[model samples]
Target: MPSEPAIASAPHLNIVPASVTPLPDAKPRRALKVCLLGYRSAPYGGGQGIYLKYLSKALVEAGHQVDVISGQPYPHLDPRVNLIKMPGMNLFETGLTSIRPHHLTSLTNIYEWMGKLTGAFSEPYCFGRRVLKYLKKHGRHYDIIHDNQCLSYGMLDIQKQGFPLVTTIHHPITSDLKIALSAAKSWTERLLIRRWHSFLIMQRKVARELHHVVTVSERSRMDIADAFDIQPAGISVVLNGIDTYEFRPLPNVIKNPNRVMAAVSSDQPLKGMRYLLEAVAAVVPKYPDLELLLVGTPKEDGESGKLIRELGLAKHIRAVSGISTEDLVRYYNEASVVVVPSIYEGFGLPAGEAMACGTALISTDGGALPEVVGDAAIQVPIRNSKAIAEVLETLLASPAWRDELAAAGRKRIEELFCWTRAAQQMTDYYWQVIQRENG
Candidate 1:
């Protein structure tokens, strides 16, 4: 095999000029019938769900008829976009005992149930099988099929069947697997982590076989190409967008001087929550009244929970889950600084969202974070508790500096990251795929 290409440096997108025209084309833009597929798309499920939710909403607002075909814990979408429910056992929520006599008859259900019963994640693969079957019968209804990173063997089959297909890989799962392995406490734990990520075998194979693949960041494009052994030239980059209107700052909300906020979806090693906890603990001795607000809940027996207890942060850390965008924005508004301590991120939506809320920001220079934050927020190296703690202390001590960062961060988001702009660019790409397939 040939060697992988060198990862390109992130482009400096300081601000987008307001007067710039749309994509250069002689033809007028056409409204398309778009189908977005997601194995699972609960906004709280992860970034994939958030991607589906916002993208579909933006597409509909852009005058396209969009249909989201999704699995359990479906996305909350604009009323204009139709949602097609694809039901599986949803074993994670429904549990193993929910299985019935008839469920055993289907191979897909059996695979899903069996996989979860062991330690494997089989949702993407099972969803692909169901999607291929659904599209085989109703495939002609939509002009194009775009999958949200559900890279499975069935996707290759769908492409072979002559459907105009495009898949968006948010980031490579190989990164998650590597991080999980390193954080494992025992050989057995490492094996289980590997088992849980076994779907990457299918993903790697399917990614290379797909015709048109897109990623959320330049960093992801490079990592996906390297991880899946595809040519870097084959993958395209479309940065994820923030819903500025929803995440925008509330000037009336009172700010909390000593509150530091973070949004952590899970207690995963990649999230670097442990480091954030340590940072909070380190600074609390000097600032006894400092508060750490977590936007997501942690498993009580999980690493984060254990650390919170060990560090005596039980009173200082307040975690909330399943919050509406309004509540999230309120939290952001109240915070003195929002920190994203992830060891890696594809596009760093939390950083972008916090910035959009006009909260002063401190983010680790994980994958694509610098690309997102630019010069608007202070950035530190990933997994550095001391660095995060030091920055937190400085930001807290000087309200003027925080205000400056808050203004800069919000301006950066307003000018550079908008869902409407992302939708337009994505629409152009869709037409390109359709045109290529036609010829």
Candidate 2:
């Protein structure tokens, strides 16, 4: 890497502000060396993995040599793109009691083990230490490192070492912490929730220190600014793109009249699955055959399970996990409507996916859903089961309205959410960062 520009006053502290100075023009893109970094990017994992998979593929398609450096549950990348594995304790898989003496021999491992034992989710921090080690040895390998929300202490060191770094803060983890705390039933549960998200402290500090931050939605950028105490001006909002080709409608598939699909991860309270279930229960009396197909697992002993039984919706609602990508698309195509009842989303992938599949969508006016869907889908208020029930009933009765929403949703996705377009925009952002830093 070229020698960093000289610093005058407080030189050691490099604080890059979010600026929106437009780049000069569309110059021919230099075939840049790029590294997409993630702490834990599991393929079957929710939106983060999907973002990595498609974004890297699109960047590779645009002729950039993209390398994904990830910790445990590595990302599934295109054959053309490189995967550099950075291993961690993956303590989520290993129980805390199973820690052996040999594991604690390494100081980093010891720190990670202890953090997990104390209920502090330390993967991001531990992974950052590993990333810093890797980059120190191979600093010349990549022109730029684009991080996927692993804002840890090591990331700050890497930036200080003069590597051009850009981090995408999907949304501030503070929002998650706030929502979780609010949902906790007991004092012990709230304490545990706080401990599990302790890494947000590190992330908050790192986010403010770093330069060239990218976010998936304008709403996320704004929310991240408030949550992390970073300037919104310093953060760039790059809307997440949909894989139009892979997620397109299956014309041969017949839509189910009484079925509604929701693609979510764990039955997290933030997902607002409880509201959807209540809505489903309310609808079942009118449309006796009404069924809710959830494409994610509920914690068998968690609130979701208890609620399902309470609502007597065990038979009416089916929760399935580990479906293949093909099956996901097929479900999207066949469902009467896809509902994303998230209380908030940094970027609503479910809405975009359903739109790409030409499925009519009913989503809450959660963070970024309206921005992503853009009047293409029906919008309901947050945490309103009655509103959900009414809109759903209306959509079920009006096939013509559903058809209008489906067509509009598909067209909206096509125009605004193409992977190629996102890559091009990101590619331009990369050049701007490099050129800005060089000068």
Candidate 3:
């Protein structure tokens, strides 16, 4: 392992003034009234949900009036943050293809059902409509509306109404579409994949037209520019943060020498769990005691579960889903190393969280993993089970190297990736956007 390098501050866009600009000699008022919008917010499962939960909490802690308007699987927010629930048909709930008659009672439900049947993702659009309807009927109580990747036609209406609308494109959804298309074995499969990603066309238009766009990483910023045909300068990077207090190392937790843990969401193919399973199988023969623990459930009849069974890894694999945060931290502490083998990531939160927990990381050089891990963790190429197996073998054989990497990973997170710092940076960005709009 190498000596820990200094944590570098993320590069900011030149469009905004530096942090030292002079302002009116007035005491800072109550935090800005911010409305964060998300189509879905499942706190434990997806990145968007996690972003809504933590960012809202951070903003509230900074004295901001924060409201999260979201669809199904509402975010677990800090009690202080207001939540305005926006209901959608949620047709995908039971994994059925088309929306049944039961899904349509109201006009909104009918729209959602019909849209889903026609191969369109309707949640973002419907959620936006619900949001606009709510604001119109109830009252527009928010200063600015911050959308969490729900770029829809209704958002343009909100912008036209002169609301300061800023949308965060975590990364271009085009990447996922491209990956899926390339992996498709037949023309029919490719067509279906493209249909699934048809929403990106709308996202691209909305993202490019929106005045203030925020994203999690520079890699995502650049990719969004390329995918959406917007100038890179049009987007701002407000890096996500880790709650160090919650994710810190638990030395009291027992460390299992042969255990490896990974945090994965089952739906997305870009997560690379299938490849990791292959890597696990390749290495398992050499070390009979080796085992893999997942912080999430394997998708039923999905590629991940099928691959695990195909590789004969059922006996050595344990996936613990829906566990509490405390339990997750305990698992993080118990593991010898945490692996993030994603094919692409807007910002790899799991990598940062594992690092915060003082665990050695084996992350692929996927989208922003390199940026997040720096030199603190071992890096490998994506989708290469052989390479992953080799790295896992090396780490397993070298405890001293693992300890050094773990210490470096923790130090890197403490210095640069804490939520307090992220919140302050985001506060500045929000202030700049509002100032520019109001000016």
Best by lDDT: 1
Worst lDDT run of 10 residues, candidate 2, spans 1-10
- The residue-level lDDT of candidate 1 at 369 comes to 89
lDDT measured at residue 88 in model 3 versus the true structure, 0 to 100: 84
Give lDDT for model 3.
0.82
lDDT of 3 by residue, 225-335 (tens): 899998887888777889888899997887799999999975467888877898999999998899899988887687788888799999999988877778988999999
Going through the candidates in order, what is the number of backbone clashes in each? 0, 2, 0
Candidate 3 similarity to native, TM-score: 0.93
The lDDT-based order of candidates, best leading, equals 1, 2, 3
Compose the digit string of candidate 1's lDDT tens values, residues 315-358: 99898999887788899999999999999999999999999999
Q: What digit string (tens of lDDT, one per residue) describes model 2 on residues 296-405?
A: 87877988888888998888888777777788899899898999989999989989999899989999998888888877888999899999999999999999999989
Deviation from native of the Cα of residue 40 in model 3, angstroms: 0.3
Computed on alpha carbons, the lDDT of every model, listed in order, comes to 0.87, 0.84, 0.82
Q: Give the CA lDDT, 0 to 100, for residue 216 in model 3.
A: 83
> What stretches of model 1 exceed 4 Å from their correct place?
1-28
Relative to the true structure, candidate 3 has a C-alpha RMSD (angstroms) of 2.7
* Pairs with backbone N, CA or C atoms under 3 Å apart (clashes), candidate 3: none
